[model samples]
Target: MNALSHKIIFFLFKLKLLQPSESTINFWLQSEDTDKLEYAVTQGNYKTRKLAAEALEQLAKPFSIPALLKCINDKVQNVSIACLNALERISTKDELIKTIVKKRFKWVNEIREKREKFEANKGKKYNIYRWERASKKSFDMVKERLKRPIR
Candidate 1:
């Protein structure tokens, strides 16, 4: 699309009148306007947030990483998934580790550990493995990706 059309669409999106499709997000991702993308990711509705996450996957600016990390704990599942996909797409092993350390999983890990300890002490041995397993898996995937040369 032409610049004018792109601007109009972006304006509409900002007004919350338009829900961005993947193509619209792809167009925006290629734009130089990082602020708009960052704003949408942080404050927009679920659809916009998801689109912003998708855009971030392609753009992958270091400044956008923290915003993307915040989205991982979004109340909306799709938004969270999109953020995760973006993180996986953009982050190197070291970057992923840094993000993990920075977030500390925002109390998620602490909660899991407490729960596990409580369950173990109670002799029930709760099997809530997914939480820790997913974190480990993400780290492992990043490590594996780091071993390969980017095409």
Candidate 2:
């Protein structure tokens, strides 16, 4: 990796945002380095894993999608959120973004449907609790995202 790359990586590392060198990133993208890439995805520190996810999207490699998907369920919410945001950057790669959108839409729709069904079955009486609170929080996030100024 060049000095600039190292500096950037180090800065992000300090921020707990990324790990791995640029060349190491390229090496992970190479076919023969699949094992290393997979290991990096699983064993890398949060930043490294984040970088790996971004690299996979940049490389437009379909093989890395599964790993990226796994990141969506990561223990760290930041990692999972970053993985979702990276999916938007990778959306230009044919099925990549479409697949993620489809899955997320399905999940959101299922949640909405279930919520509606429950509300209907309950009939007239209204109670607010965990699931409703979570749903409201999710709606607020969506609203916030929608209201974001176009970059």
TM-scores for the candidates = 0.54, 0.41
> Where is model 1 more than 4 Å wrong at Cα?
93-151
Total backbone clashes of model 1? 0
* Candidate lDDT (C-alpha), each: 0.75, 0.64
Per-residue accuracy of model 2 over 1-151 as CA lDDT, tens digit each: 5557655654565565766665766755653444445546666787767666666665655565666677776776455556666565656566756777568656656867998899888867666565557888899999999998989
Candidate 2 TM-score versus the reference: 0.41
Model 1 C-alpha lDDT per residue in residues 1-151, reported as the tens digit of each score? 7767777877887787876565666677777567778778887888889888888877877678788878888887678777877776667665654576447444555767897888879965566655567888999999999999999
In terms of lDDT, which candidate is strongest? Answer: 1
Instruction: Candidate 2: count the clashes.
Output: 3
Off by over 4 Å in 2: 1-23, 26-35, 89-151
Residue-level lDDT for 98 in candidate 2:
72
Superposed by TM-score, candidate 1 places the C-alpha of residue 5 at a distance from the truth, in angstroms, of 1.7
TM-score of 1: 0.54
